[model samples]
Target chain A: MTKRPRYFNLEPIMNPKSIAVIGASDNPDKIGHVILANNVASGFRGAIYPININASGTIMGYTAYKSILDVKEKVDLAVVAVPAEVVPKVVEECGRAGVRGIIVVSGGFSEVGRKDLQDKVTRSGMKYNIPIIGPNCLGVTDSYSKIDTLFLPAAKIDKPVVGGVSFASQSGAVGSSVLDMIDNEGFGLARFISYGNAAVVDEVDILNYLADDEKTKVIVFYIEGVQRGKEFIEAAKRAALKKPIVVSKGGMTDEGAKAAHSHTAALAGSHQAYEAVFKQFGFIMADDIQELLNLSKIFETQPLPKGRRIAILTNGGGTGVLATDALYEHGLQIAEMSKKTVESLRKVMPPIVNVRLPLDMAGDAEKTRFEAALAAFEADPKIDAIIAIALFQTPGADENVAAKLVEYGTKMRKPMVVVSPGGSYTKRQRQIIEKGGVPVYESPGEAAKALAALASYAEYRDSHVKKSR
Target chain B: MALVEYFEAERLLKKYKIRSVESRYVKSAEEAEKFSAGGRIVLKAVSGKALHKSKSGLVVAGISGGEIGKAYSALERRAAKYRPYRILAQKMVHGGIEIIIGGSEDVQFGKMILLGLGGIYVEAFKDFALRVCPINMEEALSMIRQLRSRKIIAPDRASEKMVAELILKAARMYQGGRMKELDLNPIIIHDGTYDAVDIRMIK
Candidate 1:
């Protein structure tokens, strides 16, 4: 087991009891106004104090103080949305006012080649022992705490429901976009943090905090670069032992490195180095945003598959073939069903249906066929996981297949993923399957990929546990 | 970066308990002949600046005692562009899988160890796996297994263990931080025994 050092406790920043919004303004176009409005509309239970130099009247239903110094009550966190040049002075003032944490939502610091100014802001935090989240970031959102510091309006970026998955990103735009996309996909989030520029609190610190956060079951990251490689690996390794971690890194190519650096002042080192580190720590390295979300959702809902032997149960032959190809591509095996399982499947499946590994039950496979196939796979000792392709576009298939999947998925105690791809009809079925606590994907390949992620995590956990023992 | 000479790198590998083929450095053709009297030998011209010796005609293999003198003169003349070079007489090793093990200090991840297939087709295949230094035996074995040609080593458990141990040793040596980069290409492995035939190091 790797020994974990005492990381900076981020409770004050993530779960603050009292939060002060700096640069608060009455102008709706201002970032400060949107951020203050978001906090208020999000129903943050904490005491909200708005700080503005000139404004004396109420702002966003909260009385605006002249400055942070004027606020008489104790402030656990200060969300600063001021301009770039004034950020360092504001940080110093926040530090002097005994703020425990500060989230600098304003841009323009090291990202714009102003290293000296960024250093001054960082120094202020260090001198006062207060952690700073970012100098160029969207800030954080904790659904559990009802703290939404993101300046993006709720209308444009809908908040996801409170759930077990938490994400920490180095890019604000990517983080916000993913959050919005997840809301549309019916995936929920426990916490979301976009720590751009990472002047003080970086991905490593957030990962450590989320490792112990009760609400966060699976931790995800959108990393452009790592400031402290060794520390990040250690923290990630520890976190992964307790909960699954999926990472999608930017700046993999040479051209992307330049953009990453300009966007977040990230180092953007060689991709091979990051790959090795991820493999060493047993992290699920997702190739894109969608894959990251897919892996996170699977890890959040499904138990890790005991082995790699997967039984593909699909209604469409094409989907089955695609799932088979994806399973092989991901290094997962297509299980050879036992004779007993084949006999059981033979009793329910039609004569035309081949009792093979990817048992394609034709387009007419309805709820009964799915139930029979699920039962056979559940009883088969050779099959460790199942990927059920429930295509709702088929006329004979019904929504009851989702209920059957839930029943069998729980009874089997094995990981199961569903691929229900199509238009409105399939989307409705997918929502039904999702509500039944089964992860649903738009394609067979994605379903197979999710199973692969689960199998890989299981193998990694098993190996690590054996080694520790 | 400062390059370490071939003989110096061999000595360093030996000091770290990594097996290297025995070789003697000679300045003259007569010394080459004297060193190549035992068996078939490989004659190589040692120059710090010359990286691709075989491509430059500075390396001659399968040189018996009689051919040592001619090979030595040819190599010295071929390497005349980079003057002030010595000749190395190494016993010819045969019939082994060519493998490459290396390590370099990455700017972000610190020291990283690399394992891959070697020989002339190394560039064409580009099959390799990398891991951070100070890796355990399990990690080293996984690095070997990650290669596309893993089947070649799967049947021979002894060879697998040797390759894994070699990687771990190289990672340890790299973690010492003396050399900025090290390459032990074409490490021949036959019947579970291995020998590092060529070495390169940059400080």
Candidate 2:
């Protein structure tokens, strides 16, 4: 558990070989007890030690040590759940024991106007050359590696299944709610980190770490403010070059900036400055929470689009019109179908079908209609992406149509998204499509925005490369 | 909060390869007429307190060499309460769209360059684009594209290229940390080239 200079791997901090639960209590009301119980239930692939100063016997069926220094085995990570006033002493003891990393989940630090205590904790970590996550944060959750340090009970915030998208936030409430919705989104997770107050390990470190994380294919962030602007700009540039980074900045308005400053003691930069940086560095920015999640899932599921040209195929005529407006609004072009593609589709589709850019297959379209239109659009070299509006509530759309959409939308050559918003029947069908590795948005606007973001990222990478072809 | 004198600001802009309107500090009314050189010139009162000099009618424009004395006296009278620092006579430039280019150090980020529709409508419209500096050509072009009223300038490839060049120069001028802010407002974009009509810097 020794610290290495420059080449120190953060792997042990997140996916450690062993951990210790400081302040592990028997009372359910205490946060320490809930965190210890979660470690047991999360099936973390490591040894767990319980440390309590007052405990005389085993706590939670594991041997209890009075202090972290008294623990025999090497403590790779220490999850500190104690009073804010006592955190500095406990952390100093953990530092003396050569703990590799620490996550202080207690609140009542700088957010409550106690900057002196937070500074003491920071100083102790610096003296020992050890990294710390927070003094007021929920810590991190790695779904695949199974290192769950979130203090909330398991029943309250359901864990998302394992996948490629990784999320990092600056607030616990937002992180916990997003984690619960990750499962509902039918998108799995790689890691979810909440560095509230960010006493030591700030957003720049997390950005650099995930840039090299092999399990993470796309990174999402919910940041209230950024203090270290130069380092953040450089780190964000490095990470975005490797994978798509979708960011949702919380404090944009004057009112929100004031609240953010009080919430995390963050010095929120001007909204114009943040917007300029996000655009210049190629980080896909979202307007709201839903757009943030919507933009992220598409990058994880689909291949990069070639250009801004998109072809819309829909079972409903009105949905086709809406998709057109949205595509233009998002700066996407309605692709001009090739003559051969149009001729081929006309031979197969009924006369009721309008064989054009917005290929409305009508309300009575079945599985074969979707299959034909998707195949035509997929084969057209002019079309860079496809948007399939599959209304399962329609009379002719059934389970077979759902299965066919999954097949077409999941193709690796061209990027495709399905817009299917409905009641229970549609929701069940959406599950099937998402299960087969296709992303589904609820509305035409969302679907268009997702595809537009995908196309823009691809275009940026194409032009921003350093090497000449 | 002290402003760099107007002549010094123009010299700095010219040193960074940004073409700016020529002006001279006239200590007397006779010097004002001589600086005009029988062409259309503008008269302005210079002072650290005259931040919004143009808005306060401290500037009198399009006066020939014969009327330069009258314009200079009128500007001096309006700017007297502010304890005017100097009287300036500048070449009156016209015949192009106005663009406002600026550079300032942000609190979190370092030096950044800004571009917007210049003149009185600048504050009312607030249509602008900004980027951190040491900006490249592609970035400058992107900034130009972000302007909402870019079409109002009837922008062509030549004009856009010049604007981007002006932005790069602004970035260079604001570098080295000696100055705080650089504003080149109402830069007149003529057919061949552009002239920075007004230059203001703060330190």
Candidate 3:
């Protein structure tokens, strides 16, 4: 039997006491130098190192260790930011120095198609029994602890309140974009991981870990492909029933499919086969990044839908029609308005406004119209969730919109999604919406998808809960 | 793929330990009548490309000595037009469930085994489960349990152990990789005994 490394808890690296940067450079422009600077900038409480040879005693005020072997302190994690050729040697020294974890941020090992070097790295890591994060990767971060060793240039703000959404991405760029969008939406992130090249660890291992993570209520993955098909299916099956595991598989297109095969050396299964597997295992598959984040926000905040019925509230007829089209395309229904809801809507809606299923407020541009529309839908028993497209047309309309909707939404015990389509809206308006604690999406598709995803989760949650009961 | 000749297909299935109907090739009705004296017989045109011999009136079931000549004459005329130009007479095996098992090599996933609700509805219902090859007994059992027609394995209908064994044997044959395709229809399960009423194996 091939002996594999025992799975160890990796929470420390994300919340480490000290981190030593191997191959730290004096050149601020390079990855090695920038990583050390980021650690200082991000307020990492741990120790930072700028390991250099024949240089000044300090690179950036931290004592320069010639190598990890020379450092006296016990290093919790080592950030290797050197050339691929020299990474193995650096890893060997770190292993000898008793480093618990190493994040090899450098590329050109496996990504560049060098198996010999990859083998050496893998074998040494196994021999020393160290959990190597990546030979090519963006390192992990715990937003809750403010521990970010990621290579991204500009990082987002500190995390929000502890919630259960953790992100795992195949591409670091995509992951950074997701974090920025999540931050913009004012959603708290539990953890963000980019498994670059996945030379040592894979998506399945991270999913298995996240399945039991107390802070992780949901797992959102951006998977390009899987190494083992059966193992992946089994892991997805087990995890989906336990927690809401959403995936946005890149390479859905033909060109992307070619890139996926070369990048991961995985047989990207037929698209139909993938859909079947996803359905069988109850995994929510998203089409794009926007949808992934949109679903993430909804699953993070609201209760799952008990049924497919939806109530759409809008300010313009054209926008309402567009939302209707989207609902039909997405397999959602425009809820039939209850008599009381229609009666209440008619009181505020202009005679010209179509106040049937959508509860259109027309171009009245009145805050009361908006509030009345939301309230009427909130009172409707048939509606499971609400999608409100409030694009700022009339002045003073955008203000207090999100707050008012949030208040009514909380009262009704349903998610009220707000989205602002294209056009330059002031930052203040956006903040007003986000500050109201209603998740703001930038597109109608995002809001609609959020509701759909929430409903999917709710179905799973309800069944599991009922089963337990 | 052409339909496999019944007798020729059975020879291949016997290599894989799959049971088939007791059959024999006969040139004339006299040989068929003498061979099937103890019981009724089924006279079928032995053409590999022929499908639905009964629908074409090329097959006659429950034939006795008096009707054997008539049935054989009709089958021989059908066989003349049929590409194979042969006739097969066999005892009509009865009892058991009609579960279908087949194997095909999927391009991306390699060898795959398909177990489905059997009989003509196999294609109509299209209800099946697929698994990549070199499957263990546990994996085979999992596939069988996952099928939509899995209720066929319930005790009221068929013996569970017997059905499980039939599936496991097919999986082993797939693992052996000597054959390209194997389909067993109406794998009769009576009490606990099972036999393949009709089988087709192709490479």
TM-scores of chain A across candidates: 0.92, 0.94, 0.85
Better of 2 and 3 by DockQ: 2
Supply fnat for every model shown.
0.35, 0.31, 0.00
Model 3 per-residue lDDT tens digits across residues A1-469: 1354434356656667788887777786878787788778767776776686554688888789788888888888888888898988888888898988778888887667797787777776677777777778888877666667676666344344445689999888888788777766656689888878766667777887788787887799998776656666667757887788888887765432432201011122254345445645667888888778667766676666657788877776777777877777666888887888777777777778777867566655567777888877777888878888776765536666656766765556777777666556635565566655566777677677677767766675665456657
Model 3 C-alpha lDDT per residue in residues B127-156, reported as the tens digit of each score: 666665555555556566666677764454
RMSD of 2: 3.7
- Identify the superior model by TM-score, candidate 2 or candidate 3: 2
For candidate 3, the docking band is incorrect
TM-score between candidate 3 chain A and the true chain A = 0.85
Alpha-carbon runs more than 4 Å astray in model 1: A1-6, A254-269, A410-412, B153-155
lDDT of 2 by residue, A1-469 (tens): 2332332245667788899989898888888898888888888868888899898788899888899999888999999999999999999999999899899999999999999889878787777777788889998888876888887877777678899999999988888888888877778899888889977778888888888999999999999888688888988877887899999998777442432201011122377778888888889999988888888889989999888989999889899999999999988989999998999999999987778879889899999888988888889999999998999989989889989988887764999998999999999999999877788989999999899899888877777765223
DockQ of candidate 1 (2 decimals): 0.40
DockQ of each: 0.40, 0.39, 0.07
- CAPRI-wise, candidate 1 is acceptable
